[model samples]
Target chain A: MMRKTRFLAVFLMAVLTACAGAGHLSNWHDESMDFGAVKTVAVMPFANLTQLQQAGGRVRDTFMSMLMATGGVYVLPPGEVARGIARAGIADPTAPSSEEVVKLCGIVKADAVITGVVKEYGEVRAGATFGNIIALDMSMLEGQSGRVVWTASAEEGGVSMKDRLLGPSGKPINDITVQALNEIINKLFK
Target chain B: MRSSTSFLNRISVFLITSLLFLPGCASVKAGPAAAGPVVGANFRVAVYPVANLSGARAPLKETRRMLTEMLRAKGMAVLSDEELETFLARHRIRYLGGLSAEESEWMKGEMAVDAVLITSFEHYDEVFPPKIALTARLVSTGIKPVILWGGSSALAGDDSEGILALGLIEDPGRLLEKAVGGLSDSLTGYLSGKEERLKGASWRAVVRRGTEETGQGPPFYFTAEAEGGRVHIGPFGPKSYYEAPFLAPGKRYSIVVAPFLNASADRDAGDIVRLQFVAQLAAIKNISVVEPGVLREKMLTSRIIMLDSVSLADADLIFEGLNADLILTGKVEDYYDYQGPNGTPHVRFSVSLIERKGGRMVWTSDSSNTGDDRVVIFDFGKIRTAQGLASRMIRVIVEELFSGPLIQERPKGVS
Candidate 1:
């Protein structure tokens, strides 16, 4: 009886651990727009909605790195993006107007522009478990039409069973951020 | 079973206690605030001596030099220290503690400065993990000495061991450079009409706490807002300093290269400048520079007197005869190819450009070196030779002249 009870408890713990913060991801896109047509894209600075100072830059960098790693699209260098922003005299990089986006695309010779907002980032603790959470929403605007062709939002991160039971740490914030970015990029290409 | 239940209960209690004591990891971030548009396009700024309020001995002069270079790179005309000293001495001003209203007026009349940048250090340590806290204020020298912009920043040096593990140098100089670079970046970001969001706690509050602990007051006033561990400063308007480019980029223009007149005592300086000017111009794709031999032949055939100082009339006559779009003529204001006490090579010169038809002065650049310039190591390497320095200076001049909107060939179907 004790053996069976131990097995049942272990199984339940495993199930709870697997489901911890599985991440809710949703995406929207303009179906008429061809995702394959985007040959090059410029990732603008992301707006920060969280209290973390560098959350926007950190998430944007991770997303850019992951998107570039996929080799699906040519990503414009961040320095070039900065120069384009300066030349375009963008009042707000995070929320640039369609005109500014088109101007930036023209300056950097990108087919599309990617921008996003970092809604949540950093550590959160519940009960005895600690987790590093990141929530992000990204969108790609087509240069020719100055309209958003694709958008994706994802919130991910939760303490693993090992962290809760054994006091072992979960994945680093950067790793979690990368995972969240991969999910968004997967949906973006899909 | 009783023992096991007790063990589970203990574990549960421990988890609850840990949760109750969980530390808050919240941080604050400040973004750029909007400000009015910048008033002027060009500004001549004077950076006063940085007062050291940090009890620790800091390299104030080195920091000042670095800030000067940064400002110059941003296209600001920074008055050299020697010029400042000369002006102060001529005015019988023995000590420049701070800029009073009267002194500001005097500076305006004497130095023709548009702004005065005052800086002070509250904390600067050079230990294994260096720390630097600095405050800067840009005061306009207009009729009223209004504070155009202000900022304060604090930087804690990165762990040397960690940096070394990442395959980077962790020397004290590098740490200090990083700290100073951050401070300069903040200052320039404010001055150039961009907003810099500072992370971490309020540097002013931190300094105030330190002062409270040390039983002293902060050296400078705290005008910046600090809340939720973040300090928000200025948008400070757009960058006003402008250097007119000789010609806009992407357009091909024919230019006549005139021999540079030697104004310096160095006899070969003129030749060096002229040779470098022609060589660099030849390398630029958008500029079609007339060959030196061709230019001389044209001058001789056109009966144009090639004098040291070409007047507007002379420039017009030459332009009409040669049918060139622009004339590039300058004087070698100064040139020195010598090694410093530390075996560092140095080169300095000044050059200017003019439009041919209207004889309008378009661009001018002067190189200044005080032998105190810090050597910056990059992935590519450092400038080591006089020729390299000359080439670098010429590149800066060329970039300044041809700096504007980059012209791109639009696709057939795209606007």
Candidate 2:
């Protein structure tokens, strides 16, 4: 009975998160190259905005899962490209531009690239209330386009450490990601 | 044959019932319970040591000294480094963690010590301001080290540049003094109790309900919570003089809402007084809504969320910061007392809320509710219970303002 209740709770949370996602994603451009035509696409390293900060590799991992889970696409290894950048002695480890973007695609030999800026990642704590919010805006281009195609971004906002550890919250992190991914996918499809 | 079987069942049921009641009776028997002051054989602790974690050349002497002095002041016969070192050597104990019960027994046998306190300071480097990080802990033989208190504080040191450039505080003596003192006081209250058990791990949270600085019983204060042998409630950090003691975490506890009367009474009177206050506090939305804090997490989840609990000092500083949309205040007036024809006691309480803007009260609401109206009465005299009073108060207050429509916006669940 307890396990059943837990399962029901998770299902309910997913629904609520989907519901909340509709509000934040309203912009972006998806250059309509047939995603169906491309079996595998390479996602280049993302841009680090807002002064200089490292958000760990979780951001990259999240994008990988979010993109693949969208269907009709597959991602090449990010590790191989990271090695190429290292071999090339890239001065900046966090942010890469158009030239580096091209070089990265060549190293991985893939269809396209995705890149973006991390707008904010902060933890606001006051009294007994604690809130963690992470927001980023991303763009996907034909690896060499220098022309932006699909761009969709979303903000994950809310209070964590609530009723249950990793419980249903005002705004869940995963929900926000799915919302942004859906809107971006719509543009890609369009 | 049927009568015999029925009689046997009754006897079995009676025996089972007695087994349950006996524990309850022993719990409340009240025979000068001997658990407070950590006499000789207590075996749990959290030692938070804040030092230089930042790879800077700042002196950690003052912080280290403050720790030893503070623990000593708390009246625990703590072990010195030499003694701790010798004991560790004797017991062949290295890496102070991951010890089995047999290993623990060996250590205790060899060292004659049940637990040891270990802490380290992290991240001490600050360019303009003095940033200090401390980790305090208390570890026993088998239990994992619980962090009693660990956080970094930036004392406005020598940088006169103010907010742009935080200055390291010239003397952290006072700040350390207050933080330790508050922790000590909270520990004392938490440990002062008689314990009985049923279920998972438990701890006691005690907040002091009292008069304001104006000699009027309005704003409230809190003592730190003692749970599972760990103390929580940020050491009033830089604020020293208003410290409470270290607390004990026990499942069974008595929460004295308003101790204007005897704290020992387990009857309706105590609970009645508590309920009246809750109803009053809840009527004002900003004053208390969807209560907060991990320590107070249980309270908000309770049928009644405690509201009339902001002390004058805390409230004053909070309002002075000009942070809240509006400051709120509340008070309890006379209780309606009468005799029942059946020789039962009945009580009712009155309270009011005042909103503070600028320097004066801008809005006020008066409310009163009978205690016995909600819960049925069976006896007289000491007639209050935390649950009974809190429930009545919660019902009244939540209905008036805690509803979703009344709030500014639906608050996202607070972590």
Candidate 3:
């Protein structure tokens, strides 16, 4: 009886740890962002892998909102650089050329630019039944070097679509955004 | 007099040769194809999921062998087999998992993979209680797969077309072979459109009809080089227009680069623009899409709404690009009913319509019955009719968009 209880305890701990939190589970992989004496970070328009057009902008806003809210890193507002793109006539706003990224940095007046392609977003559906799944990818880069300091992608397959579809309006990927920040925020400072 | 006549004849011959050869060289060499600075000519391609059909797992050996053969047929120096394995290890996936556009760009920039193809497909049996129909769809990571024209078939084992057997039908292998052959044929047809043989660098384009000189329109006459793509002028036509070659999935790096250099040449590229727009709209149709293209076209034009579908991989790209007042995107998915022992009826269907925004989705109605699944076994026609599902999704979505910022009037010409 004592041995059985001990075995169960170890198994339970393993299961609990898996379900504990994003950081604990994510530490298996080295997903950290380091600014390395760089202060200002220009968050480029994140890629939109979803069907939604504004997804990239929202991701940009979320990163901006969360980071700016933290009062740690200086974020460059897209509105400030919209003019430069318009002037350069980059028809597709999201797909800024490397030259364009550099030019936009000049306008934003930032030391580094954080930009990456939005890897994915979608729902898990069984026929008409719904399953919640939301995913995002973010990368922070230095403006001058165009080198990525940190890159991370997150995907959530079991998002609990039942709750959102059944209950009131709610953001499905808010936790992803929060977790994304938490995953890299400290690493950048360090 | 004989010497003067001979001299005149020699001069005439010389004049003719120069006339033909000089202009040919000048026109061919004058085009922007020769103007742009050479960017990264040595393109490195990260052929992920090379051996797999879609992002999902499949029999690696057979499928990959076939896919590699196909790429080799295209003269693609795709990364060697070992390189593909290394890439898979780096990306942390067993297969390529179908890189998204952003991921493709990142790959091109980081790993120097000029292009990437992400794919997903399902090979399953649809049981209509007694009858079983087998189908497969090769979907791009983000866009709906181009049905390859022949992936869907109406034949079963025993080589008896349209006959559904009780047990696993006889000659199941041959039946699938026929289906795949048909599918490959269609994919070839679609891939033909992606061929940039006549693709050019000039910004100018014309929608030409057949001329009297040649009975058929768009006929080729001679061989010439246009931008990065090769142009063929057929023996049939006197007139042929110039165009930049279309971007084929298997080969895009060489094509995309030329356009980047002479930006003006591709600025008004109607083909690229139309295809990109179609890509945007096609996403909607693939994501649990049931409606005919007509309804989508009508609703799209009549509203300030931007619409499309997204796979799990590209949720971020779609989200970022679609920062309109409202955005609509979802996925195409299905479920299997494994009740019976070996004969589980696979009700194949695409169910998706989530990740909505603008605080819409005001209402939703669920209709998944316990037994009924993706394959409407008995109701064959009903199940195939996408309007039942796709349109309903649109109705909910349309109603939501029109609710607020998707307002019809633009605040009395604030402009």
Candidate 4:
């Protein structure tokens, strides 16, 4: 009887943990912001912290695709965003000042500007397990007030037990990146 | 039973891992959306030179040319570079920034334009994975030139690597072309109606209902007002000096040029006018023009020294002699190279188009550089000689006549 109870308890714990581990999403947003007023948004370059050289740009592209897919926003083109950055004379595109953000928004005629950082990306290996991973942090700043209106951070991807035991066939980097992006974007909408 | 329980545990672990790695389940609330501008067809607009802000040296002129073509394809009457430049110079407007109320009224009264379009390039590069970004705005030329419609778009080659790798886009130029093509489509779509896709790619746009003011709404809706209604009473009563009626559509007409009469003191004014008319008429695709050489030979052979205004009988005789549908005759009323006050050169001339069937006047128009017209600052005195003024005068007249609704339709499948 003791053994059976222990097994049942372990099974229930596994199920609950599986459900809880679907995503880890944390967000911070200013309550005073009128999101409805944000009709246009410029997506700025994302800072890359990973070893991969193109990780930042890859993640940024994914975020742009997902954000535009939401249909609630008119995402300015990346070239336009670069122009706005140049016109603002931002010394550091990844980390711009509040004043720079406002100036860029005004130049691009965007209601808000979205920026992000790619924390982790690419394939990883741990002993007998292997998988692709992606982690990102994103923020939205209002153009007029130059205040951060919304923010979200998320991390996704890990080796599944099935893959680990069955020979560790990892998912593609692009797939993992997209899944991680979707996870974080879901938080923004929520 | 023990072995079966172990297998079940393994299965459970597999299923749990799969579930954990799957996409997350989150719901999004409805957010705010933007509306596109509603504009009428055939609105006359002037596109200012694109302001290049891209740190790189991008081909701004090519981009402007592409934009102009796209606007024309959408049935908008875009002003030529010469015309716009002239207007700007005459008014002493150096910058293309937001126009003041007084400047806007002046443009409206003088140019008879409905809207002004301004475009700025934010980023443009032709390097590996070329990139381009631009923003455009259409402002009304009303009492206040408020922004009526605007859009911004950017695209990079890196964003389309998948398509490139798949051999969809063969070269960098093709990729840039695709990007600009998408931008143009999105812009035109926004102007005409709401597009379901936000960007030009596969992403679908969320539809928002109702007009929620964000302090960016247009001042007023635009209506299609009657165009080219201004009439000037020249020596003739209430004749069109700046506007001409559009020619009948779907008709092809052959034109025979008769030498214009040199009413001015300058000896070469008539020849200059004649040469300019021939050159301009040759550019019209639908109108078949008899070669100047052929017409000159025929005139010399017939001993026709027809000068000044040709009488109806003489016009009819020439029309029959040349087997022409229309006879275009003109008089160089005033051709003077003014060199003194304010340093502005002026040219004035009048032209009349006569139908061959009854020798009746079909169209008569005249223009003078010395009028109160606010936008005639082309080749001001120092740069303009008599020849230059004559060329400009003829060009202005020809453009006014041919660019109107008077155009022959191409046969099916030719375009």
TM-score (0 to 1) of chain B for each candidate: 0.38, 0.30, 0.36, 0.38
- Residue-pair clashes per candidate: 1, 59, 60, 3
Candidate 3's C-alpha runs over 4 A off are A1-190, B1-47, B50-58, B74-79, B90-95, B100-103, B110-114, B121-183, B194-334, B337-358, B362-415
Evaluate model 4: give its TM-score: 0.32
- Please give each candidate's TM-score: 0.34, 0.31, 0.29, 0.32
Alpha carbon lDDT of residue B120, candidate 4?
60
- List candidate 2 stretches off by more than 4 Å: A1-190, B1-51, B58-62, B89-115, B122-133, B143-154, B157-169, B172-415
Off by over 4 Å in 4: A1-22, B1-415
Candidate 3 CAPRI assessment class: incorrect
**Cα TM-score of candidate 3:** 0.29
Kindly list the per-residue Cα lDDT of model 1 for residues A157-186, writing each as its tens digit: 866555677773766675567668768877
Expressed as tens digits, the lDDT of each residue in B358-382 for candidate 2 is 2222222222233333344542212
Candidate 4, residue A179: lDDT: 65
Candidate 1 lDDT, B293-395, residue by residue in tens = 3456555666766443344455676677656777776555444433221233345444445676445544333343322243344312333333334444554
TM (B chain), model 1 = 0.38
* lDDT for position A22 in model 2: 25
lDDT of 4 by residue, A33-152 (tens): 888888888888899999986577556654554555454566654544666776689999887778998999888788998889988887767575677777789999889978898998
Fnat for each model: 0.00, 0.00, 0.00, 0.00
Quickly count the clashes in candidate 3.
60
The RMSD (Cα, Å) of candidate 1 is: 25.4
